[model samples]
Target: MGLTQTGTYNTRQLQIVIINSILVVLSITAVSLRVWARRLQGLGLFVEDYLSIFALALSLGVNALLFQSLHAGVGEHVDTLSTATVEAYSLNLYVMQLFWNTCLPVIKLSIVLFYQRIFPVRSMIIACRSVMLFLAAWYIAFQTTAIFQCIPIHHEWQKKTTQGKCIAFVPFVTTLAATNLCTDVLLLILPTRQVWKLQIPWGRKVGLSAIFTLGIIVCAISIVRLENLIAISNSDITWSDTYSHLWTAIESSLGVVVSCLPSLMPIVRLVKSRGSRRDGKSLTGIGQGSSYPSYVRGPYELSEVSNRVSTGPTRTRLRAGSSHSDLIRKQAGDIEIITEIDQTVESTNHSNNI
Candidate 1:
């Protein structure tokens, strides 16, 4: 089709889309590989994480679709669109605006859901839920505003004629942008305090907390996104470049992933911990694999248990098999028996349900 002043479909947009598509696939793939790395043992986590990853993938798909529609519909316009192009223009704006706005928030919500398993504490979970509620409110407000942003959702052609009747695009977008950035920063800040309260060593706390504090990443990316939005407001219609769209996609995607990365620590550790368990000789979750968490030692029994358990190549039982009772006695033999203890330790931190 021939191009017109409304805009011409440019190769730059396509390139941005292609790169973003690649990123979407790669991100999802990495998460999927981790979830199903060992199919038999880890499949329980598959459903939840697949949804998590799917949201990310879907957001990317929405971006790509909208990217194509905006270019094709707008670029093909002739001088000015007529009754025929009205539907096309309307559809383009509606789809593009909805995709860019809604899909991103959906992805972010998915991340928050995945985190439920990570922070099992009642208070922490409550905090996460509250933040999610706020995100939902923001999403609703933006979507409602977007739907009403244009007059009749089909009257951009005569848009200037009814100037006083409709909301200006700049004010609407700028308000949305400011609120979004604030929410982004708020969501990012919410988790750092929880990370700070972990009982881990200070260095580990800092390092591990950094992973959860990816609000920093969100903050940084939001700054970049703010820049991009400004550029987009004055973007060249005749030219298409991947840089602007690709970066905006990053701004949106990164927030979801940043919120998500914390929840993944348990997954990564579960994989690694399971590997160590297998190599150390555990074929069942309730077997030695489960025993590891409770297998603490005081001086002599540490050596005794270490000596008794052999991860040999052959499935041969050399030492006299010790019962759980015998194991306790052994633990008590060389040191004061840890009898007076109230304990509430779950199996394997089992937060991720692994």
Candidate 2:
């Protein structure tokens, strides 16, 4: 059998590959279905969630594809691949190469842009803009480090001795990882303090909190994946060495999922309301349409209540002076509500990726 080579992935690698493929499918489906469900419920096609979902699709796919390539040289063919631990670690570095070069920085940037929706106050706006600048600077520095880490780039996977030509990796990736983790925590945390001030219900506050919790989830991914870096600090290979790849899968996948969760609220509320309508007719019917309809509209108009009347067949007499409230609510609802009806932005990010 000659000297058995370490790089051939064997069944274990295949299994992990399959598992990663499942995550890729789940992440894509969750985001896509969530998007579709929004359209179904009239939540409109939002770019915020869809962009991350699509980016995850690319990042995860590249991770999977590139890892499988490294696995190709495993078995008795020792010379075809580098040392086992090094190959796996480098696979991570390369997967990161794909992500940093193409995806993560972009995802983080778009996420900051989406923040403007929930935060329109001047200072919050400026802070969020600064976050965008931070994201851009990080991306530029990150890709530079990743590119220089492996000489000729092809040597990353091709088994060539990088010899003096490539930049030593520890400083580069660890800095990248630390910076990434820090920013993930910041992006997730910054908006939340501002979100707390919203007059939305406690449950809504909790929901916003849950959405921001994704930042913590991202933090965990960073921390846990750091273990992989430590494992590879000397470029050692083993199933343990690759656990970080699994963490990477999780971290990026969940970021996309959590990013989209807030957008799904309206979809969920819309569905439940429909389900309730199906189960039984309403006594007051005030809560009949999407959400309390009162809550779905903005706080400014619906913030207070007063006498109002409905001239239509229902003859529903609302609080009188609340007409101004209803007018503003109806108008605001008119524009925002239609966002749920339009369904075409879905593929736009795919183009962005291309």
Candidate 3:
């Protein structure tokens, strides 16, 4: 193993610290936004929020464990470290691997749960539930594999101690990376069809698609991380794996941040609303001259509510003197609700007409 040193600090170690530090800040910011959105909506911090917080906490554990590994000489040349220190580094790395596996799925589960609350379509709900189940199974499998991957477990950290054989590290890492990429792609595509099918205009659809596409950033990161993992030589354990370790930290940290963004809709709306007022123009929903409605349902609920009203034999009465814009706004609170109000109102009214 070779070490990169620069002026009193190990370059690899410094890189890990810098990357994980940024991740910690982002993770905290993302979780805070998620919680603030709940408070803004008066949802009072539901289960999904708790799940996200727990995931962030676990991510912090991973970050801390990585730091511990570095302290024990993980980023230095293996020859420079004592056998005992190397063994300690091995143990820290093992714990970090477990936490990394655990944290990713937990954060993903939180995202799925958030989707469930926002998208009420029966099919979408079923899909989200299915994803949740798969994630739960994945979580169990990950922890089990991490725990039992090596014979007699302790040999995982004490590789030189016994003749205990263990799963090949390269294959294990490659497989883990592949599986993570698959899930990332799944999550990235899961919301696209729903987003495109939204009753909003094509421009808005494109804009929204772009937002969901941020998941692609995480996906790209995963791919690079996987490539690094595959390229790492087993000979230089600590030195060669530094890039993989850095990307893993980045991948999980960004996962938490990206998953929490959609939930921050309320905060975004509040900020946009305030900004628009100062410019002498109110934020429009879906179309020209359309003002926001009072009902203020989030984007995720728009389709389900619209579907229910259109399918039912129930006529909707516009609140007295409520204009077309108001009705459109009533169905969804997001700025994109600038859709045609008369059409929506008539359909809703016809559904309810006796």
Candidate 4:
């Protein structure tokens, strides 16, 4: 059914406010926990951390604009709103789009950078950098188009008085939504190949893959948002676009949450390890049979431990001691896989004399 602007109010206004307000609080909490996790591991912030902080800032701006639009009668029928109120809502919506556009790319970049930090293989690094470049270009192109979609910028909201041309709304939005969805899918796939190649046990590899692929939830949100965008009618925009705005807010904030999740793993491990210690349980199941001693290092940092063995040839390999699960858990951003290499080789003569 077509959306008709016959009613005085759409009850969805309250729903939008409630849903988005809760999301804002959650995103803030997720980022805070991420920072705390890093500190618990005694590590300095990296590029991904900074980018997530910046993305959270942008998300807050977007939320502010959304609330402003709601106050400006964005959920009311156009026939019920005063001309000035309509213009106010339109103006808020216009600005919110720009912020939303910028915010999504920033969130994706943060995730890509996180991948770069955790999976330091040469091919993974190259792929991540390529994705980073693509995201930067994506943001520039879409943001530029959104900024100038109307020939005279104010015409976007002041349609009556402004004599100017503007791009077709539905087609432009369709393209934007399609591209966003594509990028989301690309990001979801980027880490899976590298994850499966890890030397960890198959169960551990599956667990890590699950953590990295959490972005699929965000992608599903994007698909729903795109569908809503396609189905919306331009005439009753204030009413029809309510769901669109809701999903956009959701997708953006949820992106932040997903991006921060991996980083928050360290905190989870720390809590679990403490609880296990209190219960007098052993955390040594995964590291059994390894003769090397390994120390905890901050997630994503490489550490090496050298040992001399009298009977064996020199060998080097990735070792996870009693903290194997901790290392696996740190893939979220707190675990480090220690490298252990026997630095000394026993000479045959020395071995025979011994």
Candidate 5:
């Protein structure tokens, strides 16, 4: 179809295709990295991983529906399409909104569930559960409203003059956007304090906290989408709402990718390790003879425990193997016997899954 208002070609579908394509690719990469990280750690898939997968699947459904709507002339001028085409687009758009609402909350819950596992502090876990409950309630409320937004849902697709009463679009969407922003803020703050209390250094703690804080990006996108949503009117919904559509797709897709990023820490550490070895540097995160969070140490199969230093100049070691323990005992003679403590701190730091 040709452009109705501009001198340039109508590139709505093209833009949608490109954005969704990139998003799907990133989603796949994120999940792949999660699986790889899990295999490296020798653990089964966990709840949060399944939740992320569900969210990704819903996102794909939304993408496909949006593309189908475009084919039905959703992004073009309404005058350019037949009555049947318009109806098809309307139905598809409604279905897309259902999937969009579902996808956003699932992704949020996945991240929150992850926090529950990683930070077992009683207060933090309670906060995480509270947020999860809020998200679940929000999803159901918004989805139900969306379904019945108009009296006789089929009227949602009717022509402007023929369409029956529907709730005010601006208020409904604004409420949705505001709730989304609220949740984003809550999720961002949920783990910051807990992470701050970690025994790690100031810089490392900040760095770790920043990862959880990345939800602010989604909040910004939601604000942009709300702006576009407010601009939408009965005058030219399909055309005017294009920006809102664009941001919605972007926000949901970006959320999915960001949610999975924390799970990819193991792969990142591996790359850093290889680079460091090639440069002839000592391996960091391991055998440093200094205590560090196991997650920072990267997911490794090694079973070596660090030697713990006491208050004075004396130090003790934890031995895993009995034969080696005997050899060390023989060598040290009168030295204090090193009690073997299992050095494996569950590396679920990235996954935070039990």
Candidate 6:
């Protein structure tokens, strides 16, 4: 059955659909760039990357359910919808909740896995694994609870039936949101100590820490979503739930986007490096038959030049310098800032020895 219209039949369903549609597109783009960045560095796709892809897939599923719910009159007043329309909306929402619960924890796990990849210290790795295990348990428990929340699961959508008992929705949802918020905060703090211990410049250390903690934005969105969920009323639930769904869409899509921000850094640096190379080439007339060899432009070029002209100890020094440069480029490209820092320290020691 189609949505019924009353004298006061205003609906925000279109707004929800439009906002989520845009967010889904953005999330897709972010994940694509993350994959591209890895490929640019010649790195293989890691567990975190695969997990991100999975999370994005689940989020897409949730968005599809959301659109279906909206089409079934999810943003109209309950009284304006026929019983069948309301049932359809409720069924869609029920399925959406399961997807939502699954998608969010996967996003967090992906982030945690990324941390484990970047920081290989014994304590840090242990902490990451512990968090990952906890998240797995959390996801399983919540998904199971969501599936069987009502004594007869069909009663969740077939609200007119009074035979089956259901758990209190608000309390269940509030507890889930609260635990999710706690995990967000934990993940935000997990890497801070390690970041501070980096041997890089204090400014760079702070910048790196900030990048790792970008999940704070997701945490803030989670808080807002929890508040919105709490304020939603059962009366006119179809209309009231629209705002809740809007926040859910924003939170899930933004989580994927934020998780991807660090990986996108390599692309930014690659673009900037290309622009710098172009400017240098123009200023020096390097490609226009200048006296200097074309291979004198940068570290990679210098390494090639040195290989042909240098000898003995000079050759050793040149090769060492070239290796250092290569190491930095590869580490930066890989988005392995921690390894980059360690290599920076080792490169400094090697320079002093030479």
Ranking of all predicted structures according to lDDT, beginning with the best and ending with the worst: 4, 6, 3, 5, 2, 1
**Top candidate by lDDT:** 4
Off by over 4 Å in 1: 1-11, 14-18, 37-54, 66-93, 156-166, 233-244, 266-354
- Model 6 per-residue lDDT tens digits across residues 169-227: 87898888889999999999998997788667788888888898899998999999899
Misplaced by over 4 Å in model 3 are 1-7, 280-354
lDDT of 4 by residue, 1-354 (tens): 111266333478778778889999999999999888666555568888998999999888887777777767666667777777788877888888998999999999888887886677899999999988998898899899999999899999999777989999878887999999999999999989987876667887788789878999998999999998898777888778878878888888889999998887656656665566444332321121124333333122233322222223222332222121222222323333323221222323321110
Q: Please, what are the lDDT tens digits per residue for candidate 5 over residues 236-314?
A: 6677766677777788878888888777765665576557544433233211113411222223322233323232221
**Model 2: lowest-lDDT 10 consecutive positions:** 334-343
Question: What are the models' TM-scores?
Answer: 0.62, 0.68, 0.79, 0.79, 0.77, 0.80
lDDT of 3 by residue, 8-107 (tens): 4477787788888889999999999878766654446767789889989888888787767776766777777777877887888788888889888988
Per-residue error for 325 in candidate 2, Å, reads 17
Give candidate 6's error at residue 250 in angstroms.
1.1
Better of 1 and 5 by TM-score: 5
lDDT comparison, 2 vs 5, better candidate: 5
Candidate 1 — worst ten consecutive residues by lDDT sum? 332-341
lDDT of 1 by residue, 1-354 (tens): 223345544454455556667666655655555454324222245334555666566566555654554444443323444544544544554555566677666656655554454455688689778878987898888898887776665554344334524566545655666677776666666656766675555886677556656667767766665665455432332122124345556665554455455444434534543554433322111111211322222111221122222222111121222112112111210111111111122233222110
Write down the lDDT that model 1 would get.
Answer: 0.48
Scanning candidate 5 in windows of ten residues, the lowest lDDT window is: 326-335
Where model 2 places Cα greater than 4 Å from the true spot, the runs are 1-15, 41-50, 66-70, 73-96, 155-164, 233-235, 238-240, 282-354
Model 6, C-alpha of 263: deviation from truth (Å): 1.3
